[model samples]
Target: MENFIIYMAKASGLIAVFYLAYHILLKKETFFNSNRWFLLAGLFTAAALPLLVYTKTIWVDPVPMAETATRTVTLEQLIAYKQYQQQMAEKAAIEAAAISINWFDVIVGMYLTGVLLFSIRFVLDFLSIRRILSGNIVMKDGRFRLIDSEKARSPFSFFNYIVYNSAQLKQEELAGIIIHEKVHSSQKHSIDMMIGQLFCIVFWFNPLVWMYKRSISQNLEFIADAGAIQVMEDKQAYQKTLLKITVQPDCINLTNNFYQSLIKKRIVMLNKQQSKKLNSWKYAAVLPLLAVFMLLFQVETVAQEKQPAIELIKLPEAKVKFAVQIDKNTQDSELEESKQLLKDEYNADVKYENVTRNPEKEITAIKVTVKDKGQSQVYEVAGHQPIAPFTIEIEKNNSGRNVITFGNSIGKDNFVRAQAFRIDANGDLQDLANDSMHVQKHKIIIGSYGMDGDKMPLRSSVPLKVPEGHWSVNSLKIGDTDMLIVINGVKQKKGDAIKLPLGQEIAELNMVKAKEAKKKYG
Candidate 1:
């Protein structure tokens, strides 16, 4: 839900930027076709920008530790280090306990409500238009349907259907009306208007979206008017015809109304001289503006600092110990027999005890009590014993309650092993073994092998969190052995290639060097 809000916000920002550019740069130009396409392209590009956020890495050189002469540390320095460690631990504990709430839920709820209302309104408006067209007098031609109506207040067209009161106008007035509505029909201006309605429904809260819809509607009128005036014998008569319709305008949301607002501007445009062809070059500005948007908002950079490699050491096998208890009332021979039985059955180092402290409680023949091994693994680092992943902990109470826990590294040997590689910007898994698939500049096929997320192997890859790099593919081929892969460099066992979202998530490809392979395996 949070991600959805973020995407909507980005889309809104894009629409605002592109529309501002169109209004300031190309709005006054007389190229109606170019203007129409420009508005449409802007709307689509705005919605797509958020999803194209390609993540790139910014690599920095590893900083070296300062060289110092070897000397014994003073007692004061040791105390200071301990104090610093304590402060950091307390700060981490405090941060972990804090909780935060996001208010974006309210914003998303309001946005969805607006979209629902506008969507319903759009559907109803279309249904109303359909109802009006169902029972009218209809005359069909090759590409248009003419409706003869005495009730229509003004002339208008919806798709190929022209609606007007034909009984009241002279033959010339009727001819002008047909030519005007024909332009709307042939150009399919209704499609553009419908696109505007969809944009408004999604971004109803944005005032600029409303303005964009109006611009699209108005441009259709301009184009239709320009085409209709060219064929009319008396251009002044067309102007007069527009005035008649304006006096009693027919207002419908889904149709191209004849008496749209800005009557005076439409008249002025009709009389105005043709604009120079060179002025049409303003449309070229949209390309660079789109490029600027991509640079500023579409690409993201993440820092990937290199770290020292890890060396895993195998420790000794762990020893488990437990205690066996016999009842205090048991005979000496019975106690001895119970202890020997427990020691043989468990194969563990077990000690026997006769309990007299709790006289009221009686033990069975032989009761073995296993101690908690949850905290058994601890490594001494810089004179401090920090708990390791293999650690376990067990707690036992006087009330006979026992709590046992397994630490994170309890299942160290149960990990899936595979060869992994980094996915790059071209939405591909970099294949160093095959040079054609290694570099992003090379074209990668969109078949099952490519990392486009279209189709993937059933269980090939696992995605890693950020800063750890993106993907881990299992068991890529190196000569013949299947190996366990870690960070796209280390290999132990064989598995399938992991599928990932490529460009958006993965960053680099780290294949094993031939020299390293020879040294490790040969």
Candidate 2:
């Protein structure tokens, strides 16, 4: 919910910035088409800005444990590590306890309730407009539909349908009305209004959104007036028509009414001089503003840097691949499971070897080898631990290639698959199976990656119920190179990532956090 709120706030801020630019720099200009596009592109960009992800990478000194035994731990380093451990422990304790009603939940409840009510209103408004046009509409000149309504003193249009009281109008007034509504229809002004209507439904409480709707409507009117007056032999006659109908009540919200309140501005814009073509450069200013928004609102993932401090071997045009060999004495079930997981998840090739015929003899260390290399990388993992996964990142920044192999193994006896739960704003919890959309709809932030494939691990801020001492949730952070989320207890060897949005109404979530979780849940 917090993340969603921040996104909405940034979205509104961006829209407001664009609208200010339009109002200040482009509003008075006679470039109607350009202004229309500017407004539309600005609104869409603002909405999309929050969904874009950006990354940053920080390189620090290497650790000694992964390289050699001569490394001594510093006091400051130990203190920082202890503090992180304590913080994780404290977080786990708070989340694992039974939740109570809180103010944040109440606020979310109110906001969703408002969304529901406004959504219903939006749908009904559409139906009302449809019902009105369905009746009393006549096909006119085979170009548009005309609705003759006795009570409709002001002319209005929705798409190609025009409604007005023809009986109460003079031929000049009728002509002006048809010409005005034609501009609205031919230009598809109602499409802009529909977009506004949707924003109002989804972000009912956002004042800037309402302001944006008004801006779009006002811009559309400017366009329609500018186009309509061109067809008039007597421009004053059209201005008079606008004045005459300005007092009438507006039609349904979906329709572009001829009698909008901006009569003076419409007349002024109708006579405004054409703007200089070079002034279009003002739109360029929007780029930096959007960049700022991206930096502020992009979701990030933070990973504990746990790569063994081994010197990297740079192989130009050489692809370094990993192969794992399991001892032949391993149980068929465990070995096959590992093989299938490797094949299905990582697409890695696996081989089996037997040194002894005894089934009870424990398999000591799994040997990992870089293809074409003489010495194999010995990974010391217990029979109960899943083999660690590694990635080879080729850096473009003149830095040598890095081969990162995780030191911790995922314990099979303690292995837990990702679990999801449906939580509402009121702190209610129900078990769900990998529903991303549901989690998102409730304003929960799911961790995601930029250069993602179909089989990436799923992470969510929403906590899940897991046994003590296992990874809980996943989040993403941006880096110059693709980094992996390496934790102590659980190993990610295959398609263990969440790909799609969970499709349910989940308010809050719980994820498994391995080390700290062990103390509480265990």
Candidate 3:
């Protein structure tokens, strides 16, 4: 997560700086400097949106729990259980996935790669242009190196040079034309293009990127106009030259002859603002821009505050024995009844056997056979394992009687165990009727840092009724973490690097509902 944040900050900061640099260094004298306001808008919008929606608490683990009731229900989902879930009519529940997505990774990867590629192209293009322009240089007018017009009235480009139809221009107009194109080179407008390309990629789906590209080019044209025309004191001389070459200016000479970049607009701006002069010291705007941008750099926490912890949590006994059978014929009874049977049968039979000495260990051979007659099925979930708290669904097979398998079914004193619950009914593995069971106020710790994890203090009562057998976790903010719809439960200390995009749909839906309600009632 920290890496992700750093990547985003770097990309954003660089884009802002490049935009500013173009305004201050290369095009300060032209209309380019005047358009810094637009870049400033982009800077504000991109930096603020993510921060505003981010939560205050970012450290604690996610907690997923339903807040229906703390009292036990009348149904018996399992023994030692006061109540079970009551059936609820079928409806769509908000997804409570607590995982986060680091879109920053995508941004960083693309930006860096694009920059490298652009640099390579710039060098190659520069080389080709230099080779062509070397033999064609006729004279230097202000910033432009006027070249010989032998080929045709073509506006061809190679690297920085826009080799123009100099034969069509008068001697005076040629100076102005060379100076204008040269301004483009000296200002490193091509470099700006490379940078703009990255922005184009980040906001690839945004139509605004294309519009902005046109805008930057137009601004550059205006800048070159102002700078080139400034060399001559007589406005009439520059205006005559400008109009003379206006018929067909230089272009990249590609299949698309449409320079919708608005050269006409560039000329008009140059005329209207001809008298205005720029003070180079205006570059001081950089300080405040940097100052404001610094405010946007954030730490990679889910949120940035502390939250309360759970009040009473019931944990299983540290060392409980489990008998797993690979035979797949074990009775699928609930945990309570099975627990009673185990209590009676294995009470005296609970003897630890060392694998080395006991070759004929009957305990290892004992299996809990489960029978399934369904047509099709996929068992994605293996019993929960390390790092990843739960097993991801294996595949999307909706049909079949699938057997839930486990590797570490048995437990010992060293390895702690709990009284596990199993889904007994065949109708649906999930508890759709959520009110079936009720548990007292017991909270699970989540998104923790160490073995002695960071606990979110629980102020509000988060009692549970089994919803779909997985417990209700969505819509509830987990502790202080920026997680929305995180599960409320004890968590193993891992997977802290997850980021902000997880479960965003549920959070947004909640916000949307709140907005609709406000509009309707108010």
Model 1 CA lDDT for position 37: 91
Stretches of candidate 1 off by over 4 Å are 61-102, 247-250, 303-522
Per-model TM against the reference: 0.55, 0.53, 0.38
Q: Which rank order by lDDT, best down to worst?
A: 1, 2, 3
lDDT, model 2:
0.57
Q: Could you tell me how far off, in angstroms, the CA of residue 453 lies in candidate 3 after the best superposition?
A: 42
Residues 1-77, model 2: lDDT tens digits: 88877778777787788888887877778788888889888888878877788666655322211011011122222
| Model 2 CA lDDT for position 282 | 82
lDDT, model 3, position 172: 71
Looking at candidate 2, the ten consecutive residues that score lowest on lDDT are 64-73
Better of 1 and 3 by TM-score: 1
Off by over 4 Å in 3: 1-31, 34-131, 134-146, 152-162, 197-206, 245-250, 253-263, 273-317, 322-522
lDDT of each residue in 320-420, candidate 3, tens digit only:
12232112122224323443433442231112112121233212223233222332222222221211111101111235223233332211111111111
Error of 1 at 333 (Å): 33
The models' CA-based lDDT, in order, is: 0.58, 0.57, 0.39
Better lDDT candidate (2, 3): 2
After superposing candidate 2 on the true structure, give the runs of residues whose Cα lies further than 4 Å from its correct spot.
Answer: 66-99, 151-153, 299-522
